[model samples]
Target: MTPSPESVTTMLYQHDDNGALLRTDLPFPRRSGKVRDVYDLGDNLLIVSTDRISAFDFILPSGIPDKGRILTQTSAFWFDHLDVRHHLLSTEVPEALSAQFDTEPLVGRVMVTEKASVIPFECVVRGYLEGSGLIEYQQTGEICGNRLPPGLKQCDRLPEAIFTPATKAEEGDHDENVSIGRMIADLGSDLALGLRKRSLDIYRKACQYAESRGILIADTKFEFGKVGDEVVLIDEVLTPDSSRFWAADDYQPGQAQPSFDKQFVREWLSTCGWDKKSDPPALPPEIIQRTKAKYEEAKKRLTQSEPTL
Candidate 1:
């Protein structure tokens, strides 16, 4: 039987010491991403958000407690609240599989979705300057062909949200940023324009809502897929794992701001002296706890009250 949401939460906390679920063993064709395990269920896909965390294009040796639950539940919240066509069919595990495998570990971390031909590009929307965007701006005062005014500081809010798409890289590879013209050239003008409009609309609405809740969605990426000729949003939506979320109250434009995502992991990895080309180090217990807390806090603040959208 499917456990109640309350029961699932209880189970997650109780099972924290059992360690992060690094992998799954279901008897189905599966594809593992940096943090999710996708199982083919014929008509639909079963996506299990694992606790595995990746930084510098490498899956780290350590996992954060309850990280899977945070990402899955957070995405579920957005799927329900966002007014758009999406690939999510349900969050409940099918009875056929639940009856066969021990599903207690899957509660609050599984999504049953309609399988679609995933688009090859990531739809990235930025409302602020940071990350690779900031670096590119520093060098050429442009990001993915979008020109910006001079003297913009790091983390400064952009004049408006910009849709900067990137090629969805293979596992262990970096996603390369590209211009909208490139996207239009690759994927006809109509389809490319449609994606840009949809992505920007969703980002604007989500950012507004997030700000009202004391969080700033500085930037985020969305993935789309085609079920026949209809394009729909797929994959995780606005989760910390896919977005740069900052505390609205702590906003500062000239320097790097504190974020709710995996900043701690990246910071540690950068300062630990691990060469970017080699295997990353396991996160210390303190880093794990701090990272987990950031994710949990983001989930709580963003989903505490449902938006009217």
Candidate 2:
């Protein structure tokens, strides 16, 4: 189940006492996305991942019940797990700010990151045949640059994970997948190579480990920023926001399988008659609850524990 766009928006304002999402009379710096409310705090960016859910690029009416928290906490988990000390600077986040602003307002979904100019690329890594990859395969017989084995069905795993890079666009703009060469042309060749190499490494490592844990990392997106010659991962990693996660136990590949992601929201939109261009339809309460649970389940499955409320 997924939420109606209206209902989802309605659900976001409510938060538990654990922390409150901080709002200000002074508006946040205005880089808007489908779900995140971003604030620029000097050298740090206060990122509040909201419960809002999007399907087909349209923000659905119903929010994924408690999705914001799951995304926030899940991102934190990955930040800590990777432990590379690159973009995340939660510790440096003002405790005073944390105390004054309602953290539970945003739940554990808020992050204070060292502000770096975001790389203009969406570092995509694919380890299976599905979604965009499947479409590309059926239409062109190639995904990114790799050819697939014959008889592969939807949701089928690939022989190996591959790095698929694309350009990150502004709100309402679609991210375009370009070859490494184009990436080099836009962002110097050296940087492009680094992004490609690192994107693949992260995906390879994360997917391999996730497989060991009974989760299939079908695909995931990564963002990077440079902190003096060091290429560090940025933005959200492995969440339903940026990745497609599948249950390892239920592995069947002929058609779309149940996923701990936005499957419901996507399905509902297909029947809504709303073109993917305009605002999407609101999800029913049942869909909202299911979508919310899907988020929590993904976080739980990945972290092996309940997220901090």
Candidate 3:
């Protein structure tokens, strides 16, 4: 029988800044998120991840030692392989910040990128049945306006993956689902369809590659930004934290499947019995260890490169 993904441990937050929003040592950054610290240094963007861990939206009090390295390194692997036009600066950094931070330590996770006007939406591509797509299908009979085959189960593969665009919410807000009409109304029809198509092509290609590596890419998020005349893929791609990774050997359709990403964290939260509306709990050592291992294993298994975790 498949087990439920829930968590019992709590994620307590001692610090609000996870080295993303406001940095003291390096030049101040324009933005920070649960895991990434970003700087707009004119010619490039500098991203750094602190050791902070978060679950269910709460940043934990304890920080993992090498979590940042793992995140940075994996992104490097993706940026290298994607070959899509992107905004990138090496953490080799520019001559500017090279004085203090060593480039080698930030591999995979840290990216020096050309800053662009981030598109207002997140490009979510789902090649399988799961998560929001599944929930949406069960309720509305459609996913982001695309109808799905009836009787699809929790982890079933879709007839074909589809692109579902969502408005980007502020850091703590949830992104509401929008229809193709809604997206086209906001972004002209030409741009909306263009974004959707590009999203599908990238997702399909990445899904095939992940399958080859013995990992299943369920669904993943991507961000795009415009640089002058080009639209580029921004942000991280397919990290465990960003995407769902199912062990290929054990994947099944009718019920929830084992996920290499967030399975331990989710399980602990459920066992702890915290209300989803309440603040999240702190992660115990075992949970943290397992979570870290899952992230690293997913990155390595998919990319065939270690992510310094």
Candidate 4:
């Protein structure tokens, strides 16, 4: 059963021994993303989901407790259920490295994955109009260079799920949405179109499953990579951070809907009076607890399993 927000509040607001894992020093080569620190392990990669959370392209001063575990578990759930080629190999960190790193940091938060040559675009599938899509529709009545029917309100379901590709951004830079034509120019028509097809397929299947679980997958981003002649899904799958999930019972199309992700963090940041140019204000304890509850609720709804320590 899902834990209540009040029940998780105390634990969720407490910091990890290592506060907001900014980076990791491992024997292997590592690259730190906004929330993950990945270690390159020759033929495989060790992907560690950290407690860190990012907003407005900036890593926040605080993190939601157990966030790493929630994301890792949620992605593992989807990767296990999805009928497609993916890069996940195992969620276990090697026993040999057990002594090298603290078990607390690695437990339920790491994956040993088959490495692939990662694609440089984000394959975004949107089922509802919000965020950039809403903004784009208001300005030009289009999204990802695809024209939409007139008079679509905020959070309204699209005519159908649309695959909108965007160029992957550098650290601290914004990811810019690109047209299908642009994607074709960047990675050939065959591969670009293939990404779109796979993205839409995954989104549709996920939507059906999430709806059954009382969650609406508004949209999600996917990263893919080339392994020999085939492109397989890589990076994180549909976790709260990657997808916009709304409570199915409370969903309303005309306005922003209550969500089960970092929408709370984003909303708080938007009104916190911090200039985008400056360091983001630290998230209040209440905000942290609320965010943690959202991530946990998302995992519970989709997987219907308690998070393992």
TM-score of 2: 0.86
TM-score of 3: 0.86
* Residue range 1-309, candidate 2, lDDT tens digits: 876755543453543232223222213564557777777877678877766666666665556645767887788878787645458777334565545443335546677887776788888888888888889889877777777777788988888887778888777677887677778889998888878877777777787777777788888989888767677787777788789888899989888877888777777778868777866666677676677778778888788997445
Per-residue alpha-carbon lDDT of candidate 1 for residues 1-309, written as tens digits (9 for 90 to 100)? 988866554543333343887877577898989888899999999999989988877888889877988998899999998999999998888899767646877877899999999989999999999999999999999999999999999999999999999999977678999999999999999999999999999999999899998999999999999999999999999999999999999998999999998999999999988997877777789899899989988998999933111
lDDT of 1 at 157: 99
In terms of lDDT, the best-performing candidate is 1
Please, what is the TM-score per model?
0.92, 0.86, 0.86, 0.91
Ranked by TM-score from best down, the candidates are 1, 4, 3, 2
**Worst 10-residue stretch by lDDT in candidate 2?**
17-26
Query: For residues 1-309, what per-residue lDDT tens digits would candidate 3 score against the true structure?
Result: 643322111111123222221121344555778777777777777777666667766765555556666666777777778758877667564555545343433444467788888889888888888888888999988898999878888888989888887898887778877787888998889888888888888888888888899988889888888998688988887777778888899987899988877678778887888886766766677777777777778778866875563
Q: For residues 1-309, could you state the per-residue lDDT of candidate 4 as single tens digits?
A: 977755444332335443544445556788888888899888889998888888878888788877888999999999999999999999987886765444455678888888899999999999999999899989999998889999999999999999889899987788999899999999999999989999999999999999999999999999999888889899899998999999999998999999888888988999988886788878888888888888888899899997544
Off by over 4 Å in 3: 1-25, 100-108, 276-279, 307-309
How many pairs collide in each candidate, listed in order? 0, 27, 28, 0
Query: What's the CA error at residue 15 for candidate 4, in Å?
Result: 6.1
Clashing pairs in 1: none
Position 250, candidate 2: lDDT: 93
Query: Could you tell me the lDDT of residue 93 within candidate 2?
Result: 40
lDDT of 2: 0.73
Best by TM-score: 1
Candidate that beats the other on lDDT, 2 or 4, i.e. the better one = 4
Residue 77 C-alpha lDDT in model 3: 75
